[model samples]
Target: MEILVMGLNHKTAPVEIREKLSVPANEAMGFLKRFEQKRIFDEQVLLSTCNRTEIYGVVQNHAEAVDAAKRILCEYSHLDLASFEDKLYVLKQPDSVRHLFSVASGLDSMVIGETEITGQVKEAYLAAHQNRHTGKVLNNLFQRSLKVAKNLRTHTEIGVGRVSVASVAVDLAEKIFDDLKGVRVMVIGTGEMAAQLLKAMTGHGARALIVSSHHEERARELVREFGGEAVPYELFEKKMGEVDILLTSTFSSHCIVTENQVRSWMRARHDKPLFLVDIAMPRNIEASTEKMDNVYLYNIDDLKEIADKNKALREGQLETCAHLVQAQTQYFMDWLFKEFNSKIAASGS
Candidate 1:
């Protein structure tokens, strides 16, 4: 069997293309099953994030497999296949293995060395496994990939100076708050990064949460599920002073929270330090807020620096991972050879 990866990433495609191809959670399993039924591959795993949409597979026909995956991706994205095909990339066999390993290791991430891809990899693997689309080849590849990733994290100091944007937000918060359980965090927007940061804080025993968004109804739904209150976007600054930690990420082109706005909120709270994490591009918080005494502000660029530092540290340990995948791939190839030889012997006999 030939292994391959076909897709576009943040490096290859812009955010516009990436978002269009991104698979939603509800549609992922169905897509995998459809690929299996079509015999597009012997095994298939789809990895879709904000920055990438990739298919890792073991297929009998590389060209057919690439075409089918591309077709399905285009259908999902509602794009014209001819228009989007030129933007995609396809890698076969050994190179595919190396590419996937690099991806799972976060070496290929837009923000190189982020830990999010490992979880995305695991999710993709699990989706394939659950649908019974994975065989010995994929099973070994994913298991070995995970092990390699673990080693990269443990052995490398890349994760040293900084971690993820979410972790950095929590790190700054932890330093300010003696206890997170009592603090209230108001998430100003329903964007993924803000949700992720809030979830991280929730896992750390943060109990009080208030979700505010332009779509108040959706915010109410999330609030109901997560057991938080829903405040309207108009009241975001009003609620800002009430919450201990304020995290914001929205698609707004203009500033949502200005330097003057945060300062005005500060006056109501007796100068209590507020942990604000801005994970939005173009930034959600004003730059001047960083200069404020009680306002600790972190932007996306700052978190990206942390991810880059960790990536540089992890690059050195990838060789050991390379060996691990090489050994596993050789084993799979050997089994494949043995099976083919047995088939030939039986036919001759």
Candidate 2:
């Protein structure tokens, strides 16, 4: 059996490219089902987020699995393989093991040592596990990968700084406004990114917090925890014009705010500056809205630019993180091939 990973991340591709493959988790189940339907790989897990989308599988033949996974991802993304193949990386065996360990440990993230990727990786694995798409090999691999993350965090200084994209986004907002004082904020989503962004911005002391969610219950929960006043999802458009900072991080499949809508809102505000931060994978705000007067729009890639400033600070700890992940990867591989050898011997091979 072979461990394989096919994916693209913020390093290899930009948001516009990655977003095309950023379907909701429910939709990712279809990718797993297709892999099963084609009998390409018996074990599969799909992970999609703001920065990357990956397909993990264990198969007998590496070439066949890689080609099939590429075509399947192209079919799901409606993108031609030749068009995006240069951005995709196909990792095999121990390399795939190393890649996943780096990811779960946040070494591969744009934020360098973000805590969010571990949770995201765990969610992806659990979803596959509950759907019965994972087996012993991947089971041990993911579980070990998680432990590697904890070991790196506990043993190193990677977690000691402003190491989250949310904090980076807030840093940019503060630079723009000088401070958060009396800055009205409207956050239009209820995902984890939304919560983190809200938490970071709240620490700066915003004058108001208006939260809207596609699901009312989640919005109410955020409001209660963040001490924000909940607003109806449909009214986000109307309320957005009233705030100085507009942050959106939702899992909606379509744009929640359009260019035309923002143009209209700007007119109603008499050209007051509106700082918009859209960290959602599919992007809740339209891309074209960035062109309008007094309208500042920043996405995940923009936040990455700010985060790069602190990457040098964490480089001193990379050796420690690498050693931990490499040790974990080897541990997984030893167990993986041991199981394979046992199965082969049991069959009298």
Candidate 3:
């Protein structure tokens, strides 16, 4: 069997494309099962994040697997393969293992050294493993990938002064205001991304925080952690004037914060500056809001510029990380070969 990966990432595709192709954790098992029923893969794991959607597998026919994965992705995204065939990546064997190692180690992230992807990788692996979707080859591969990721973090300076999307927003916030001493920061979303933004904001000495989410319980959870007020989702806009910086990371397909609402909010603020950070893939804020006066809007793509600067700062750590990944990948590959040889020998006997 051969190891194969058919996917797209932030580097290979834009946010719009990535969002279209992204498979939610709830939907991953269905996709994995589709591949099994289609006779595409012997072992499979579906890994999806805001920046990437990758299907990794151990299969007898790499070419057939790649073709089927593409067709399935086309059907799922409601777009033809021709529209994004150029963006799709199909990697085989040792390269596939190396790519997984790099991704788990955060070397392949939009913001290098961000720790979130490692957890995502583990989540995807375990989900597949628990569902009995992964066999000996995939089990060994994923376990080794996690080990390699841990080793890199322990041995290298990759985590030192790590810059994330949240930090980038904070950096921009610092430039806009005299200081965060009196700034009222609010995160209008749920999950760790929401918590991350509030943590970064508060850490920068922001004076207050308002947590809001589609679910009040999730909002309360963040409020409990961040020492903020939890505003119901419908009422968050009413508190916009009290909010100096508003970061949005939601799963909404359309803009939750629209231009008309912003107009009213600005009137309420008396045209005061309101920094808007849309870190969500589908973008929770209206794109045209960036053109409004005294309203600063930055989307996920905008964060990349600042992220690139951070990448430069962490460039020194990359070579060491590279060496670690290369060595671990080779070890995994050797073990794979040995496992395959032993299986063949046993079958012959």
Candidate 4:
């Protein structure tokens, strides 16, 4: 069997293309199920994040699996396959295994050696397993990749400092404000990142928060946990007018807050500083809005740069982690190749 990965990533494509190709979380299980039904590969896993969407599978025919995945992804994303086929990087066999191991270990992340990719990798593996779409090949691959990631964290100091996007935002907040004890925060969306940031921000003596999300239940849950007030999405502007900090992470495709919206909100505070962190791809806040007085806006890439700086601080340990990934990738390929050979022999070819 041949293992392969075919997809576009943050390094290879802009958010416009990345977002267009992402599988909606609500639809991943069904889409994964449909892929299994086609029997295009021996094992498969699809990883979708703000920065990337990758499909990994082992197949008898590399071309067939690539075509199938491309078609399925294009179908789900509603994009023309021909438009993006040339843009994607397709890795096969040993390179595919190495790529995934690098990804799981965060060597391939936009911010090299960032820790969140491990959880994202684990989530993708769990989702594939829950859908019954993964077998021994992918199971071992992802499981081992995670183990390597854990070992990397242990053996290397790659993740020694502030690691997550939430944590980094909190770090930046500390730089801007002398103390968060009196700062009022407003979280624009109740997604995972926003929720995590809310938790991080709370410890810094944040005065209050207004949680606004499309899903009221989720918003209420986060509000309760973080000791914040829950509000509907419609009340975002109202909350924006009252807060010193705004952090947004949502699944919305369009800009939720624009320059005009912030302009009006700014008038209420006489241009008091408002820290805006837009963690979502296709950014929830408008880029133009940053030009407004006292509005500090940062997107995911900005945080990623901060993350890269954090990663660079631990360069003494990164080399050791790289060696570990290389060693583990080789070991996995040995077992994987042996298994494939045994399968072929059993077929009496």
Candidate 5:
């Protein structure tokens, strides 16, 4: 069998296209079952995040598997195969292993050196492994990739700065308000990103903080940890009019904040400037809300400009990261080859 990776990411397609293919963590097992029914590969791992969706697998026939994988994606996304074929990329063997290393190490991320992808990759691997969708080949590959990621972070300067989406959003908030000191920040959702945003905002001395989430306990926990009030989900919109900055990262399928709602909130606020940062995948805020006066709306893609500047600043560290990935990739391939040869000998093939 051959190790292969096929997918599209932030670099290959825009968020609009990427969102169409995103598989939430809760639905990963169902996706794996569907893919298994197709028999595309002997073992496979599906990774879907805010920025990318990829399938890494060990397959008997690379050509057949790739075709089937594409078919599966098209079927699930309801997107025409022809429309997205050019956007997909395929990598084989050592190159595939190298790409995994780059991704786990954050070198392949939209924000170069950002650490969230490491956890996301691990989560994907665990989901597959726990469900018995992965075997020896994928188990070894993912384990080594994670080890490489840890070594890269330990031995290099790639993770030295505030390169996270949350940090960038806070920076943007600071730029808009001139200072976060007196700003009333409201965060919807209690995910990691929302927690990070709350911490950053409070650290910068934001006057008031309010957190809302589907899970009221989680919201209250965050508020207790960061000195904020916990508002119930039903009242998020009603409370929005009083906030100077609104940050949302909910996992809802539809937009939580709409143009008409914002218009009403704006009227209530007397046209106060409201900076909205929506870092959700399907997007928590409506696109039409961007047209509202004095309301600044930014999604994950909009943060790419800030990410690009940070990427340039960290360009000097790329050579060191590249060398580390090359060394680790070679190490992984050598191990894989030995394992493959040993198996062949044992089977007398």
Candidate 6:
């Protein structure tokens, strides 16, 4: 069987397109189950994140599998196939394996050397394995990729500095406020990203933090740990006028904060500058909000500029990372070829 990867990422497409193709973590398992029922590939795993959505599988016919994967993605995302065809990339065999290793190592991320993608990749693979959608080939490939990612980070200086989206967001906030000492920050969700943002903001001496989530208990827990006040989800908007930086990452299909809502809040604040950082996939704030004066809105795509600067700082580490990726890819390819040859010999005997 041939290993294949078909997908698009932040480099290949814009945020609008990437958001449309994203499969939320909660919905990934059910989507994988439906995708497997179609029988396009023997084993499959879907890796969806704010930056990219990739479908990896083992199949007999590479071309047919690529087409089927694209079709399934279009159906699931409700996006037209014609719209994505130009943006999509298809990789086979060693190239596919190399791409997976690079992604797991965070070389493929907008913020080069960011470590979050490794966990995202592991989670996606585990979901597929637990549902029995993946067999020996994919299981081995993902497991090895995760191992290579760990080794690369441990041995190299790839992740030595500010590389995550959370750190970058804090960096941007610092630029606008000049100092976080008197900044009043409000986090809309208590997810991993939210917690990271809180920690970074506090470390920078942000004066206050307010945590709000659909789940009150989770929000309160985060507040307790981070030294913030937990506000009821319904009242989060009411506190908007008092907030200088609004960080949001909620699991909502639609925008939780709209232009009209922010416009009304701005009136109360007398046009105080509001920095909005939307780190969610589906996006918690509406795109139209960016047009408002004194409203600084940054989405996942907007973070790319900051990430690019950080990438430049780590340019010296690229050669070392490339060497690690090459060595790991060769190791996986040798094992894969051996497995394939052994299966052929067994069949012949």
Clashes of each: 1, 0, 0, 0, 0, 0
Q: All candidates' lDDT scores?
A: 0.75, 0.83, 0.84, 0.81, 0.85, 0.85
Query: Would you give me the overall lDDT of model 6?
Result: 0.85
For model 1, residues 147-222, the per-residue Cα lDDT tens digits are 7667666765433544566766666678899667778888877876777787778766675455555576767766
lDDT of 6 by residue, 1-349 (tens): 7788889999998888899989999999887776678788889999999999999988876667777778888888798998888999999878999999999999898778888999999999999998899998999999999999999889987886675677888877877888988788988887887788788898888844555555788877877777768888877777776789998888888998999998998889899888999988899899999999999999977786667666676777888988889888899988887889765345335
Off by over 4 Å in 1: 163-169, 172-179, 183-349
Lowest-scoring 10 consecutive residues by lDDT in candidate 6? 340-349
Q: How accurate is candidate 4 locally (lDDT)?
A: 0.81
What is the lDDT, from 0 to 100, of the residue 7 in candidate 2? 89
Clashing pairs in 4: none
**All candidates: CA RMSD (Å):** 7.7, 12.8, 11.7, 11.2, 12.3, 12.5
Higher-ranked by TM-score: 1 or 6: 6
TM-score of 5: 0.62
Query: What's the TM-score of each model vs. the native?
Result: 0.60, 0.62, 0.62, 0.62, 0.62, 0.62
Candidate structures ordered by lDDT, highest first: 5, 6, 3, 2, 4, 1
As a whole number from 0 to 100, the lDDT of residue 162 in candidate 2 is 67
* Alpha-carbon runs more than 4 Å astray in model 3: 164-310, 342-349
Q: Which 10 successive residues of model 1 have the least lDDT summed?
A: 340-349
**Candidate 6 residue spans exceeding 4 A from truth:** 163-199, 203-310, 342-349
